[model samples]
Target: MGLDFVTVLFDSPFAVMNTIGLIAFALVGSAKAIREEFDLFGITVVGLAMAFAGGATRDLLVNRVPLVLQSPVEVSLGLLGVGLAVALSVVLRSPENHPITLVADAIGLAAFTTAGAIVATEATVSVFGVVVIGTINAVGGGAFADILLDRSPFILFDDFYASCAVLGGSAYWIMGSVGATGSTAAGVCAAVTVVARLVAVTYSWNLPTVQTLGVLSERMDDQ
Candidate 1:
C-alpha cells in the first residue's frame, strides 16, 4: 500500500499537489509552534495537524476515509516537513516569518485549494461546495493550528488569504463547466491561487473591515 501510494504521488498531479501541501503546511505549522516555544512533541502535533486537518475535513465532506489515516507515507511526509522546520530554525533565527516560509505557505495554500476543488468536483458536488471546500482546504489547517495555539483563526480577520482560494475554486468550476480538461482546470486553479496570494503578501493587501468602510463613507459624505 505504501509503495502504491508513492507511485500515485509520482504519477498523478493531484497526488503530487497533495504531497506538496502536506509537506509545506507541516513545515509552516511546525515553525509557528517553534516560535511559540512549544516542546518537541507539541511541535510535532501541531505540524501533523496543519498537514492533515484540511485534507481530513475535505475527505469527510466527500464521505471518504481521510488519506492521512490511510497512509503512513502521508505521516512520514509531514514529519519530514517538521524535521525541515527544526533544521531551518537551527540555521536561521526566526525562520517562521522568513520570506521562504511565507512563500511555502502560499504554495501550500494553492496546492490544497486545487486539490480540494478537484476532489469536490469528482464527488459531483455543487459549485458552492467546490468553492467552500477549496477555501476550507486551503486555510482550515492554519485556522485549526491557531486554535490549538489559543488564538482566533487568522483567516477570519486577517489579510487577503482565503479569498484567493475562493477565486481559484471559482476559476476551476468555470473552466470545468466550459469543458476544459481536468488538468487545465487544476492548473488554472493553482496558478490563480498562488499568484493572488503572493501578490497579496508582497503588497500587504487586506480586505477592508466594516469599520474602515464606515469611516470611508463618512469621509465621502463630509467631502
Candidate 2:
C-alpha cells in the first residue's frame, strides 16, 4: 500500500532502495537520541515511539490507517536501529561520532517527508494538505523526542530543518502531478531535500529569529 502510493512519483528500483534507505536513516536518528541504556520496556517504548509516532499522528489527522501499525516490518526495523544505536554508543563512548546523529536526523526527515507526500497523494488530498502531512510525518518524531527530553524541537532552532521537509514534500507532489513514478520522484525529492539541509547546516544558513516574540513574552510576564 505504501509503495503503491509512492509509485505515483517514485516508480523504479532506485526509488524503492531510497525508501528503505530513508527509513534506516530515521531509525539511526532515533537511536542517537537515546542517551542511555534502559530495561526492555524502556527501550521498546523509545523505539516504538520514535518509529511510529509521526506516521501515526499523520494518519489520524488525515483519517487513514497508520502504516506503522499495519506493518510489522517498520516496527522490527525500528527496534533493530534503536538497539544498534544504543549498543554502539555504549561501545564507542566518543564525541567524534556525535556529528553522525545530525546527519541521520536529516536523512530521516528527508525520506519520511517523501513518504508522506506519496501517501497523501494516494489519498487524493490537496497539494497543501500533502505538504502539511509530509512535514508532520517527517519531523513529528524528532519534535516529540525533543519535548520528551526537555529540549527545543530541532525544526524551531536548526538550519532549515522543517524547511527541507516542506520543500521535499512539495517537490514530490509536483513530480507526481507530472505522471512520474512514486519511487523515482520520491527518491529525487528526498535526495534534494537531504542535500539542501546538509548545505544549510554546513553554511549555517537559517531563518531570521523572531524578535517580536521576545518583547511579547516580556510584556505578558509583567502582566
Candidate 3:
C-alpha cells in the first residue's frame, strides 16, 4: 500500500514529510528555472538547489552535513527532480502561476514546515527556533532560486507565505505538547498550513506594501 510503503521507507513522520517536500520543492525549482530560461543542466542544478538549499543551510548552521550529501536516497530524489524538470520544461508553457506550480509549492510548504518543527523540537530548541526553522525550510530553497534569477524573495514580499509555515510549526509544537504523536501532529499541522495557503491564494490576501521602484517610477520626480 502507498501508506505502508511510506511508513516502511521512513522511520518517522519527519522523514516522510521531508522526502515529499524535497520532491515538491524540486518541481517548483524546475518551474522557476524554465521561466528564467535556464539550460537543461542549469535546470537540474536549480532543482537540486531549490530542493536542498534551505535544509542544507539549516544543517550547516547546526554543524552537520547537508542531508542531500549524507543520504543517498535524497541524492536519488534530486536526480529524479532533475529528470522531472526536463520533462516539465517541455510540457509546461507557463511556469508562473500554473496550477501545477502553485500546488507543488503549497505541498512543499506544508510538508517542510511541519517536518522542520519536529526537527527543531527534537533538537531541544526554543519556540522561536521552531518557527524560524520551519519558515526557512519552507522558503529557503525557493529563496535561493529567486536570488539566482534576480528576483525578490517571495518570503519577504508574499505575506501569507511564511506566516502559514510559522503557524503550522507552532501548531505542530502545541499538538505535541498536548500528547499528539508525531505523525498525527504533523498531519494536523500540515493540513492547517495547506488550508491557510489555499485560502490566501483564493482570496488574494496580502500584507500592505509601499509602492516604490528606483528606475520604474510611475511619476517622474524633478531633481
After superposition of all CA atoms, the RMSD between model 2 and the true structure is: 6.2
Q: Whose lDDT is greatest here?
A: 1
**CA lDDT of each candidate?**
0.92, 0.69, 0.82
Q: Which has the higher TM-score value, candidate number 1 or candidate number 3?
A: 1
Model 2, which residues run further than 4 Å from truth?
Answer: 1-33, 36-40, 94-97, 212-223
Ranking by TM-score: 1, 3, 2
List, residue by residue over 1-223, the lDDT tens digit for candidate 2: 8777656335553345334533555455445355544455665565556556777878887797876777666665676666656665676664124666667767777777876777777778888999998888888777776665567776787848889988888888888789998767877788878898888878988776668678788899999
Worst 10 residues of 3 by lDDT: 214-223
lDDT of 3: 0.82
Q: Which stretches of candidate 3 lie over 4 Å from their true place?
A: 1-8, 209-223
Backbone clashes (count) for model 2: 15
Off-target runs (Cα >4 Å) in candidate 1 are 1-6
Best-performing candidate as measured by TM-score = 1
| TM-score head-to-head 2 vs 3, winner | 3
RMSD values, in order shown: 1.8, 6.2, 5.3
Local lDDT at 178 for model 1? 98
